[model samples]
Target: MPVSKPLRKALQHTADECIDCGKCMTYCRFLAESGSPLSIALTALSADENVDALSHRTYDCSACGLCSAVCPVNAEPDNIFTELRYHAQANGIFKLDQYAPLLNYERLGQRFPFKGESLPEGCTTVFFPGCTLPAMFPDATRIAFKILKRNNPKTGLVLNCCSKPSKMLGLKSKYEESLSALVHTLERKGIKKILTACPNCHVTFKQFNTRLEIVSIYEELKKSSFLPVTPSVKEVTVHDPCVTRSEDSIHKAVRELLKAMGVRVLEMKHNKSNTLCCGEGGGTNMHNNAYARNWSRKRINEAQRTGVPMATYCAGCVNFLGSDYPTAHILDLLLVKRKSIPKPVAFPFNYLNRLIFRFTAL
Candidate 1:
């Protein structure tokens, strides 16, 4: 596989900037275990003989950006690995079979993409509950919509995929097409503000569609007078989704909401900006399931050390962490009055939930 000149230059630039401080490796389980940080791996890739070994290392990364986040020199290994994925895909060095299930899921989303229920006249804000939220917690989705509608009669609902899965899969052109269509739809409908439930969707809208104002549902709920009855559980550890690590406001807002519901928030050792990935990040589970599970195990262990149940806002995070820990979504605390933690939906049910949302909610 021949690397393009641009990619080679990018990799070389990252290699040159790396100081081998080992800060990134401390945050990266894959790099720590493999003993190959960007400093060493990218440098090795500069030689053609090391491409195969380096490529395998690149795929091993979850691209969760933990390394980049802790990099003192601003050498973004995650970005470099992303470019490497593109390079591998272009040169036909990477196999797509492992990614077929995720690809097919994205394809289904594209095929039956959700449309927003129209807003009343002069309304500009709509609730863009991302795909997973509706699928995993249908009742929560409905409750969120009802609250939004109650707060503002013109509040609308938009159910659609944000195409993060496609982006993570290194299908740049496909992701752009999906994103462009979404932006066009919002613009066409005169939507100026989006209240997003999923952190992935919130970040995607902020990155790709800057023309619109993106606010988390947590933030919106904070301002509104809507408060559901509190659940039986009082104290739980929070697992912030890795994608929105930089967004302190979302993190604060989630905690505030939990506090309002009279739930005592137990802080994990890794919280806010320093949070770990939920193992499902960057589509790593598709290609490197073992590596992904290692991350999840580490996070679950940390939560267990706190001696409290784990709670997260992202449906994806809840699903991933719930397999190992007594994980619950914040919505469960707010919307449900149950005494026990909700069970994570099983394999086929997870897929079926998405389909159910596509047909019924959309």
Candidate 2:
């Protein structure tokens, strides 16, 4: 159900173009440590290989687009990973049990119904909060709603799955079905502009089509001063999302926002354009939680060196990190909370990095 001529063509093109320069493997925290080109290439060629824990490997991708960024032939390992994900899903091998919290996501979308609370009144902008944020981090969604109301005033949220989780885990039919539902919801609402908090969903939407103005919340924040800056957060480290920052300038806005909040920010050695994956993207956690945990731990330790709280704009990153250290989402940090939980973002980027490197390097 997932394969098509265009999809096949794109996949093979990327596969054929690979120079096997090993440059991608160099920075590939995945291949650099546990992976091999032969295995990765096989996984890409066809999803038939046992791949033994291939699901875990797929989920661990972080979908950071880094491989594509470093490729000499522009083979785009990220794209290969994306296609393989769909194949994995089609084979019923890549289900996200870790995202159980978001199981209510689809129900919530249908129950809440983006019918009444949507924008343009017959125009095109829709507020799409991916499954993770609304279900796991309600506060961010609350803040998102508050800001959307304050800024656009007329715009309303379009509740739906965005198909990111489904797509990432390789569920082709489900992904398309979810995407169709989204398109129908928007069309029914007469909405055009799509504003999303999750970067992965934003990218999925763009991949399907670019007819609408897909804007990120961080991007919207840059245009207007809706939320007040927090002077208390004098020092903090920012974590970038692998799937989100491929070619976007939003991470810069995040740094700017942090500066505005009075947070003296320190950059990660792999920050911005070369940002590291939280190890949870690319559906890796669903494939291999332990490996995902190790990758996340590595990142957490990196932030710990700054001797400051770790901050990220992504809810998934926030949830993954919040399990261990004093990790907080930028939205939660920015929002003045009456009662707060000072938990840190937990998951490590890699076990090796966590064990081998110390914070002094940061």
Candidate 3:
């Protein structure tokens, strides 16, 4: 697990680019409270001093990309932190045991991928509902696929993990190999377009496999005539997942979907570009549950301050944030007809949903 020369150089370059203006620190909750801003940590890395301190700071980062988003010089501290994780791993400073559960989850996904057989002959577009959605909301997953097929008869369904867990965990080589293989498989099957349900999957596909067209299902739904059997809820605070902070189009589509369902969308204190992580980004929650939960609680508290329930498009977000406050997936608000607010999918059931989707939907 030697760190690549290019990555080392890139880390050094990122460190060199830091001007110590403290903009990233001003925005990053982890850094602001911890007193070890990325700029300071990167400087220490370049100086080859306080290596242990640097490793701790890097591991503690949520990798939400907010630091990078606010960096005036585009220093990309978030990317730097990822590279630092790899660096620590190569140096035997970071252990894998803490992340065993997440790694095992990813291993299962890679081993038991669910490539559905519901596509028409010569279909070039596949609806990829990523692992979380199919695992948490199988019915919504099915409905989304049917809507896609209705809009275009050639639309198909492909259920699989996007290997984002590996990527976020700094298993760079493994992630690249698996993702590339998946992309090649889809290309061989003439999958020119991928309709993604998970924001992480959407970002991962667009980042790793640029050869194919990657579009969010939310965006696709906007172009279709499908309307949700609106729920009884009137207003909700939309928690835009951190992965799609830069994806204005996806954000717009999610809000529009809510408006179409006659629900008034309330903005969180941090929404859109400034949205906080749901504690799952960069696989931080796998290693640091308390830290992750604190972030989720902060978000839930903010939503509660608005006197409305929390709503998010990401199934992962709903699962994590729902524990702290009343949270529902936008699909639940749009699609489910429950007389009461929908509950988040619990653990064993979520895992069961993944298995059921593979056997039944495929």
**Top lDDT model:** 1
| Residues 111-230 of candidate 3: C-alpha lDDT, one tens digit per residue | 755444456798999998877887778888877777888888888877667888878766778888889988898888888999988998999998884699999988888888987885
**Tens digit of lDDT per residue, candidate 2, span 125-184?**
657766555544555566666777777776766655666766665666877776886676
Better of 2 and 3 by lDDT: 3
Candidate lDDT values, in order = 0.79, 0.64, 0.78
Score residue 236 of candidate 3 by CA lDDT.
Answer: 87
TM-score quality measure for candidate 3: 0.92
How high is the lDDT of residue 188 in model 2? 66
Which regions of candidate 1 deviate over 4 angstroms? 1-9, 33-45, 48-53, 113-117, 351-362
lDDT of 2: 0.64
True-structure RMSD, every candidate: 2.4, 8.5, 2.3
TM-score of each: 0.91, 0.78, 0.92
TM-score (C-alpha) between model 2 and the true structure: 0.78
Off by over 4 Å in 3: 1-6, 27-29, 33-53, 113-118
Ranking by TM-score: 3, 1, 2
lDDT of 3: 0.78
Compared with the true structure, model 1 gives a TM-score of 0.91
